[model samples]
Target: MNERQFGPELTAEGASFRLWAPAARRVDVLLDKPHALRRGDDGWFSADVAGVKAGARYKFRIDDEIDVPDPASAFQPEDVSGPSEVIDHATYRWRSENWRGRPWPETVMLESHVGTFTRDGTYRAMIDRLDHLKTTGITALELMPVADFAGRRNWGYDGVLWYAPDSAYGRPDDLKALIDEAHLRGLMVFLDVVYNHFGPEGNYLGRYAPAFFTDAQTPWGSAIDYRVKQVRDFAIENALYWLRDYRFDGLRLDAVHAIAEPGETPLLGDLSRAVGKLADTTGRYIHLVLENDDNAAHLLDARQDFPRGKYRAQWNDDYHHAWHVLLTGEAHGYYRDYQHSPLRDIARALGSGFVYQGEASAHRDGRPRGEPSGELVPIAFVSFLQNHDQIGNRALGDRLETSANPRAMEAALAITLLAPMVPMLFMGEEWGSKAPFPFFCDFHGDLAEAVREGRRREFAGAYARYGDEIPDPLEVSTMQSAVLDWLSREQPPGRERLALIRKLLSIRQREIIPRLADAAFGRAHAEDGGLLMADWRLGDGTTLSLTANLSNQDMPLTAAHIKGTLIWGKELTASMAPWAVSWRIG
Candidate 1:
């Protein structure tokens, strides 16, 4: 069959969809309603609902059973395989006339939940929110994964379908419209795509296509079979579809360590090459950002993973973990191994990456990480203080995590924004958002109870830090905790926090300080009290001096070797206090 005939092809009357169900004798288009489809001879059935308009919802009437929505639906409400909707991507009028993708080396990102970013969670509603982000000055926006997850009630993960946009947020056209609008507004949108495995509840792709999944088990479900030709093509094609068809800026791969393919050239490398080709063809910057914990430096090398590191970059979970544990002082689960989060860890992540590269680790069997340097591009790896997992996976799903005193939080923010690396801010982080960003999944009936029990068990093992009172991840309290106080932005504390964040971001975009640009640190001294990361130049250099006071009294700054412009903290200034950070453009 021709390429156009395969998968659902866009048509004058929205998009005409088809599925190969030779096993089934009949199939019908469950268009927003029911419409009997004319089954072709070769298991292909066609349905075109004209005038019904793009972004209109429908479901598949396979024989007589109504399941979930299409796995590849541009939008989903009933999760996966319930109903399918037709969305015309070409219709949205874009506005970002002056948008130029920030070279990743200079990437400064602001992450947000559409619902909490503004009073209204719709795509259009975020437009008003962008002005603040733009003024704050982060060049990019990383949306939490919005692939077709089940229900309108949870995080964008657990997405049953890899293609369909979830109906909970907005329709397909609405997402495209949002992207278009953001482009005009000059914000590059990076969509978090779950490719490691499908979500549990509403997934139904297997019933239609045989061999779509292999026995590769992940934290979620069986992983897609990339070794197989058809599945491989589908995975690659789906990415291409989104980039070329939907015009998205890039795809953020979630939990890439879970991707298991037996082939020589790994599926990840293949995807990277293909995505680059598609990006070239479209004359657009379509990139792949992998969320991997393997601490493999080759993934960042252009020629290592495939044709030189198949992906543009990998998310530095080490950076997140190291910095997070340092800031929160809560070491449970993987955080248990991070004993030394001295300024050196931040500096290494700032300059040469792969912190665990050939290093000994008790958490990972004492094996050294070896070598994680040589990928000499600054800001190639994204660094953040808080993310969905670090913040939401906790019993509280809290952002501030009790350690965010103004002095400490501000210092941490300076480290994140002023370092020689790409910075990402979690939703509501700019204004000290009280939103908890908890783990919220929708599981009805028996599965719901299973989820609750499972969540408790998961946290049970890590109860050493918070003690036994860990709240269940599935609790209603968890979900309610995630709601950001919309009024926080107007309060005095919120205003000050917001001002600090805005100023930091603005400096990241416009200012060029030595610490933000320095590659080598002349000296690094770590003490039980804290560490002083000093960047010394021949004449005058900057030192990103930060201290965290876990102890009762004030911790002193002892870096006299390097000099720079003093920005924050009372050690250097009478106004700031302990647990503070100062940036001097020495």
Candidate 2:
């Protein structure tokens, strides 16, 4: 494992602490008594304290002024503003010592939020639900950001401390135990990390090290200055910390397009190369995914001549938008871009990787979006019907199950789960839990009011009709409402949905996974009356085909064109019923 360049390093005698505070004239480690740190020419402050041990709580006093938690803290016993706790990573012994992780092609991801996954809403609480995911045919458990953020509850994007696991969820060991138990159950865990900007509050880097950021701005806050070597290393080491210490199988970098690194060696490529080196050393399949709206196909291209690192896949928003428009017929916001011809967009997404491959987007006021991605392998796209942003960003946080027709929703689900692309499900999507995942946080005072009013302004359409019915993002009740209802799985409708999902996933495991290694896009087309047909050439020489009628009206089935044995959905017939989907293999 790569030695962490930030945070405290433990030895037999005690611990050595280091902080990168270039702008500060004096820096001190606040333990039982103040210990002055020696400043280096490179702007690093270091102190080796003999008595500082694993459980000691401390903070950094900069220029005899404000006290701040370690930017690379291992654990925060309180919240982001509290003292950082020194955690000895060597103390936790792994039960799955010999585990090497599963292949990328075997990934069937379930994106979850720890605070909303269960009523208890802790890392240990998530362990009990592993069996549910395993039986549901979910192979990878992808968690939202867990970095230490302000207050007790959050959707987790507000993380300020990059290294520490949020104390709101559980202690460091509690999170390790969750991963340990998951590996034992044949499951891989992936984490979503934010690198573009920090949360709105509890970030004090500006006070001590203004060099960390530039004048550039992101949607959330100031864009990080990755052009600086220290700034670049800080982000890179954070990625290694989660994978090396927490044993996460992969990381999904949230919104890489927003990461403003205008340098020859971009942070994305460097970070991937460093991770690739780690994977080479450990002999583990450490996958890296990106959520880039730019749809830069070169980052995912496997045939690169240079040593610049490549990503495993990208979260395909095009697929979700196309499917959402087809099922619900909502054309507001970004949905308007796909509403013109949703069936054709869906076909393009399924056949090629991106729907907007160099096409002008109406949402961006006719600006071009995305690069050509047809040559990339099918597994390079992570397709999903619902994710955290699609569900929680709504004014009411209403799930698609509450609004869309059941048959249409089912058809979308079948296509998503069994397609050549990798599939991901929202936490409660399997059993169709109707719980709302509204945006929630624990910020107080002016920030709290700002968030509540900002949400209202963001969804003016919904607010105009619903008026005060929109949930407040700063309220405790808002967070509680997002909790998954486990009992729903036992209900008749839930049971039926779960059975269909399980059956589709079972077929994927038996018939699809083994052939996804090098699967390539074949072709896809859309006809009038919402009829769509698509197929792919599997890693083996077999052909996998899909035929669906997504409209309310029935359409004639061209059975002669689809020459394969039935694998899922209805058998071949003269005409396809409304919202009917069929899959075949030959």
Candidate 3:
């Protein structure tokens, strides 16, 4: 097993504490007493203390001045700024030892936030909901980042301690139990990890190690200096820590486009390679997915015979944007890029992967976005209509169900679920819950006011229309409003929507998942009237076809010659009804 270069490592005698504080003249491990750490020429301070055991809480004292928690802390029991707890990774006994993980093609992900996923908002609380997900045909549970942040509540993006699972969600063992329970139920667990920038508060690295960040700025904060070897290792090790210790099946790298590593072998490549190496050693089917706005298709090019560093897939935002425009007709922000020809964009996304392949993006001030992604397989793109970013970033944090027509939303669901692309659903999307996933965080004083003002300022139009109604991101009520009403799945409209989703997924698993590995993009086209026709060659050399009329007006089915067994929707006639969708396989 590869031990982490940072934090405390448990030895037979006791524990060895290490800190990479190159800038600090002297460092001390503050346990029951202040034990001085010996600084090496390489700028690493190390102290092997006997009699120190797991559950011991300690902090690092730099130059007898500021005290900081371990950057690689395994557990932050109190919070981000509190003392770091030493955890023995080898202590936890595995219940699902034989679990190797499912193949990537079998992925039907449900992206969830732990805080809002259950009413209790703890890892242990999430275990009770596992059966619901498994029964709904969700093969993968993708969690938002859980790394220790400043407050009791957050979206997880503001994580500063990359290794520590937030104390708010329970202990490290509680998280392991969640993953263990998931694996036992034949569900793979994936974690979202942020490497772009640390959260705005409780980040003390700038005080001790300034080389960790660059002068370049991201939307969040200072860009990480990945060129520095130690900084690079921090990210890579953190990834390994989650997969190895927590037994997570996969990891979704959040916002790689924001990660400013301008080197030949960027952090993405290195991290992927390292993950691949771990998979090779452990004989596990681990996967790495990226959320890259650049639409860098090269990273997902499976044709490359490289043994390591090949990403399994990426979150296809273009797919969501196109559907969002067609469903809601909201031509604001990035939605403007797809509003002009949403149906055509949807067809392109369905058939050839990306809609804006090397095209000028008006939203980005006319700079061309994305590369040619037509050559990649459909499974290389993870498709979803609602995610944390799509819904939570909104001024009101309303779901598509609140704005889109019910019939049209059903059609969109059919397309997203049955298409060859790997599908994902937001937490409460399965039952069509109206709960809003408003962006919420726990910050105080000036920071809270800044976040409140920033949110209102960003959506000034929304504020003008519905001022004060927009949930405050810092308010406890805001987080409470986002909780999934589990009983809704059994209620009127919720039951109907859940049935539709279950039916769609059942068909997908039965018909599509069996032949998705070698599936290739075939062709797609949008007719004059809101009609979309697309087909793909499945792994077994069968054709899967989709015909959808997303517009409010009915349209004549010009390409009605689709000859396949009807998988969903009614048999096509001369004319298709508005919001009608059909899927077939032959």
Candidate 4:
């Protein structure tokens, strides 16, 4: 482990530094200036940087090659096309000393892109908004991927430089400050990361060394060459850098199904194992959230063969698809598979990890995937009514809030927040934000033109509604419309509805979270047109049930079996109105 910034000395006393070079054969460590020494055995070259400190720079000398950036460099302001530098973790005065993570099962996630969350579009600026989140009762904040991508702006799926943090979100310290403040506010931070594929433009993988990517090609581009030893080491090291150095609580691995790695130990397992080991040493939680459409629930649960599994959760897309189809009634593409959704489907995802478990799917042409066996129930299977892809994939980039009936939106919101699974609130979904989330980019010239064509093609503008072509995604207006306007619209109906959201989340935190770990799901019942209810059994023989009526007319249930208190309501009236919910404690 040869850390940069060690000038004359041999070994770093207080700090630990490591790099991955499985193909180097003989890795050597060298001090740049007038130092007259070379590295030796242990497979790792060393140096004592007692006299030296951060800001000084050096790199990994592999085989007969010259200095290269540390495989886990945090700040590469010089650009991945240039050089890398050392960053000190102790420098950031994190105020989260008293903050430990909220328990796993009690998670209520909030997802938002850094660029659209605020006007400034920087991490430091977002920290000041933490109090607003705390009031909303969100236990965790899931930031979209911030890994190095072409320029500064992206969906983060196109990130090319795996190790470097993007410059647009302020310096590396700015992100640290944001995470530190989030922890101080008792909010866990989960960063979305792209390891599936690298972006096409500004990508220098072929320039650095030829072995970075292999013959495995994906829709985005050439998939990373994980079969090679150094490629695996590079990716594994990047995973550790975000956890061990940056102090991020967890990671949402973007599109693991697209990433292909065939090895003695699969690369996904390798990455998970490395993170798990680092978490054991740090006493801090490092959750790996893999995004898999396959619905393999065992990844979240601990398995006997894959002992290194530390997957905390995966986004339950069925919950969103069903909720969206029912609310918006727009059936196209993958959303086509989901038919007239009953409220029972949402309840199923909330209670069980998945809704399509062994069920015959008209979409897949066969029975869909199943969830994990009863073990590892502690892991959270997150569900939502809307997410980035859900909203942005729409032809108009319209969120459900923008199009769905307000009553329907409120019903979706209530079901999402109160569900047994961990809930997620998409940005702007809270205030019923009207801003559109169009697929936007800032790439200039030919790159910009290429992006526009690719998006329109991927969007599959088959509908006759848009005759010739869709507007270019590279337009500034698309990005402009994506920004969240925080100024409250609470003068009229917005006030009570927004208040209801906060109140519902508050009830969820205070009431539902305490016994969230218990898997004893009571009966979940819903009608064909109007209402949905799930009865959750608390250990004390007390039943907690969430009931909602989404129809235009008031629904009065005369059932003798269900009885409880009025724990929450989406409406402002004294009585339970249409589209209202009650968290009855029976």
Candidate 5:
């Protein structure tokens, strides 16, 4: 591991505290009493607090005036406003000795938020549900951001502390135990990390070094100033800290487009190089996935000399938007461009890897967007029907089963899970849970009111158009409403939906996973009445054909030479019924 003197490091004799407060005239390490730190070169301060060890709670007094949490804190027991707790990451005994990380293609990502995944909303509570995911054929668990936010319950994207795990979901060891237990169950754990901008509240970096954030305006806030050496190193180190310290298999960088670093070597590029080196040193399969809205495919291209590229996959919002607009027939906001051609968009995304790819986008004011991604592999895109942003950001936080046409939703699930791209399932999506995953937070004072009013204003247009009632973001009931009813998975529509996903995923593993490595595989055909067919060329000379009628009316099959035993279908006839999804190995 790259040793950086920034946080509390415990030794046998005493604990050494270090912080970067270049602007401060004096810095002091405060545990029970104040111990003055000697200012070092380049604006760093250091102090060795005698008899202070792991489990010690401490804070740094900057300029002997402002008290703040450590920028590289490992655990924050009392939330972000409290002092940082020293944690010994090596104390926990891991049971994943025999486990090597799973391959990229074998990954079936289940994106979950710890706060609302269960009734308890704790890390240990999440461990009890791991067996269910394992039984459902999921290979990886992708957790949303867990860094310390301002309050008790949050979506985790509003995190300010880069190193500390949120105290609301148990301690640092509890999170480690969850990951350790997940690895023992043969599941890879991936964490969704936010490096674009810190949360609005409980952030103290600006107090110490304002250069940490740049003047560039992002959708969220000021972008990080990557041109500064310390800021760049800090971002890169945070990425490594998660992978190395927490034992997470991969990282999902949230919204890379919002990160504006206009330098020759951007923060993303430096992260790739550092992470790639860590993967080589540890001999572990570490991957980086991105949530870039711009459809930047060049990030995935690993040169012959450098194996690990910027990212392995990116969340394919184009595919989801196309599928969503087609299924619901509602195109507003960014979905406007897709209204013109939904099926064509889906076809292009399925075939060539990106729908825009330099084409003129009506949503972007007719500006040419995206780059050609035809040469990229299919797995370069991470496809999903319902993710956290798509569902939680909605007016009512309704699941696809309740919001869209039922049959269309089923057919959409079939295509999404069976597609060559890596498929991600929202928590409770497999069973079609009726619980609403609304946007909720527990902020105080003006911040809380701001969040509640902001959500109401954001969805005001949808409310006017569809008569939708936006949920109160500040209500405790809103957060409670998002919790999954685990018992519902065994009953009625949930059971049926669970069966469908299980069957499709099983078939995907047997039929699709083997052929995914082939660069020449995965082609698609779209027809009228929302009829779509995908063909995956096998190594031997046969084609794996999948047909689906996404419309509400029967559609005729046009393929003439499709002669093979039916793998999965409600009807094996000349014409497909409404919402009929079938697969054939020819």
Candidate 6:
């Protein structure tokens, strides 16, 4: 493996190519002309094409019959269907040389889809908006996946070309420039990667290597065969490629619960170890986060050595679901369990890392799920009220601000930012941008209609009343509607909401960040009249208290222990207003 490199490795004279296709009897490198490749050990093939340099277009031919793009292509200049272009990754002049990156505990991540983040939906355009993110108190920019997919616009989870940066965004150098600019501003960039399954279209890997996928079913498609050495190599190397070559600070793996590992040593566990080692060699602080619905605590276990354990955090759906149900008062589908006791779920999420720890989930057909995560640090959980899945997957893609309860939205903002755990904000969420981030895609013909029908069928069970309201995923308007109106931030409600977010972030940095080490010392307790209270002492012995009234009426704090000057509130009042939140420091 060390002797041969995958993809096109260009030198001054020519480029060398290597591919793994165990099923192919013959493989050829397709340059200006077809060049036959000599077989290597372990069903691998290699060839050195003279006069083929950087910027050259090429593909690989299998058994002199089938022609396809390089599976490890670094830049798909013509989207997914066109030939792959050779990228000279080392040529980019990076300016973030001094940037060492931030730790996970300090990560205030702002999640954004590249295509919808800016009006142009390109890397350069998004870079123009970095100043806004930096000023908003974001430490990291979590970009939705950029891997080349089948169309002009997508959420990027349908990426079939694993290595290439989508052409719709920009060229390979353009992406590197985006990361370089972000690092120069002292903001670490984290990419969201989908490894659970390949997209339904434009994937050609199964033709060359059928063993890459297993019969195990995933929500997206077939599960990856992680037990196979080559499959593991592909996944892990892709991770290191982004971290080492692209200079990303971290990665947020999407839907890792769908990743099925055949052995005790899980795919994530191995990848974590490899990334840790890479961090050591590069002398950079790289973090890994997971988006798993199962609340897999073992992934975040710090007790185990480097590779065996040590993911920085997991996206906490428990906290979001609790907040969502409480704010909206909607009890449907998976939210049914939380409707009974939303605050209790919130309290459990605050006190421990998991709300359903070792408890039977009625939503999962009474299956016992999750283990006790009370021993984990508060930063182990990433909390948010709005994210891609929470908002875009909705029937109408309405944001939290669209709900009738403004006070609850404000309260949700307060708790999300002030909590001891790491906080994430979806794009345009800070100012409550009116744009709807609906589920949108760009597959054509019969595939397009199938996607539309499948999406409606998905929500038909939970939101039957709004079945017809669900937008077609394949329509171009659906994607266009999700684009943010950046000008809205200058207006009335947008300006007001932006101010609130800025204030919350400012308070969090000034008060919460300094007391992160003491986070585990906090406690959550509820009071009468739908009041919730959480208290903790800072390093300076100053007690910071958060009181929230979830009910639709004023509630007085009757606890004898409550004695502090109100530090954060809309007005000076003895009783908390409906859905109001107050912060007190003593």
* TM-scores, one per candidate: 0.84, 0.98, 0.98, 0.84, 0.96, 0.96
Clashes of each: 41, 0, 0, 5, 0, 0
**Candidate 4 or 6, higher TM-score?**
6
Whole-model lDDT values for every prediction: 0.64, 0.91, 0.91, 0.68, 0.83, 0.84
Query: Which structure is stronger by lDDT: 3 or 6?
Result: 3
Q: CA shift at 243, candidate 2, in angstroms?
A: 0.5
Error of 1 at 56 (Å): 6.5
Candidate 6 residues 294-315, lDDT tens each? 8878779522223334698899
Decoy 2 TM-score against native: 0.98
Q: What stretches of model 4 exceed 4 Å from their correct place? A: 1-53, 56-71, 78-80, 207-210, 302-308, 340-344, 365-367, 370-379, 460-471, 489-494, 539-541, 553-556, 570-577
Evaluate residue 344 in candidate 4 and report its C-alpha lDDT on the 0 to 100 scale.
Answer: 64
Model 5 segments beyond 4 Å from truth? 302-307, 465-468, 538-542, 559-565, 570-572
- Model 5: clashing residue pairs? none
lDDT of 3 by residue, 359-380 (tens): 9999999999999988898888
What lDDT tens digits, residue by residue, belong to model 2 across residues 1-586? 2297799887767889899999999999999989999999789999889977889999999999889999999999988899999988988999999988988889999999999999999999999999999999999999999999999999889999989999888999999999999999999999999999999999999999999999999989999999999999999999988999999999999999999977558999899988888787898888899999998888894322222488988999999999888878899998999998988999999999999889899899999999999999988899999999999878889999999999999999999999989999999899998999999999999998988788888978734787888998888899999999999999999999999999999999999999987789999999988888999999899999999888888787664656799999778687888999999999
Model 4 C-alpha lDDT per residue in residues 551-586, reported as the tens digit of each score: 677776656424677666542233346777666776
Worst 10 residues of 5 by lDDT: 301-310
